[model samples]
Target: MIQVKKETLYAGMLKGLLTTFDLAKIIIPVSIVVTILGKSGALEFLADFAAPLMRVFGLSGKAALALFSGYFINLYAAIGVILTLSLTLKELMIIGVMLMLSHSLFMELAISKKAGCSLFYVLLVRLIPSLLVGILGGWLF
Candidate 1:
């Protein structure tokens, strides 16, 4: 029993380390790129253009980068942006809900299609709820 428990503990530790390493691989590069864009004023330009839409969700224009990364890339990429930004707890909560509902769009859409789900249906299911949450969260908080 002792040997089995020790083996399990070691296995769990290895898995945790591997997971952390994988997340770091994605988050580090994304954070660096976002930081560069922010420094160069490119993010501000994009933010201004996206401000209207992002505002509806009670997020700053820069937060749109996080949403875009979450939707198009993955949660880790969004986290990278979120970590670099100084967002309020409310903003973080709203983004968290939205991303939870609809992250990794392209990859998930393909997987859903392969699994016999319609592209439109999958998109509708994810995006509609996310939009509603964003709108409601924006208004309430």
Candidate 2:
């Protein structure tokens, strides 16, 4: 019993470490790239471009980068983008809730497709709720 417990503990620790490493691989590079883009003013230009649409969610243009990253990439990438920007707590909460509702779109859509779901339906279901939450959260929060 003692040996079994030790093995289980070690296995759990190893799995946790591997998961952290996997997330770091995605997050670190994204953070670095975002930082560079920000320094180059590229992020600002893109932020301006996205500002109008992002305004509907009550987020700043910079926050849109995180939203796009979350929708297209994964939550980890969005987190990376979020880390590089200075945002208010309200903005963070609004975008955070939005991402929670509709993140990992590409991968989830692929899985949904494999499960015999239509891409359009999956996107509609995920996006509508997320958009509504973002709009409401922006107004109320």
The candidate 1 region of ten consecutive residues with least summed lDDT is 1-10
All candidates: TM-score: 0.89, 0.91
C-alpha positional error of residue 59 in candidate 2 after TM-score superposition, expressed in Å: 0.5
Q: Pick the candidate with the highest TM-score.
A: 2
Model 2 bad stretches (over 4 Å)? 1-4
Give the clashing residue pairs of candidate 1, or none: none
lDDT of 2 by residue, 1-141 (tens): 435588898999999999999999999999899999989999999999999999998998989989999999999999988888888898999999999989999899999999999999999999999999999987897
The candidate maximizing lDDT is 1
- Evaluated at residue 109, the lDDT of candidate 1 is 97
* Model 2 pairs whose backbones collide: none
TM-score of 1: 0.89
* Residue-by-residue lDDT tens digits, candidate 1, 65-113: 9899999999999999999977889889999999999999999999999
Runs in model 1 lying further than 4 Å from the true structure: 1-4
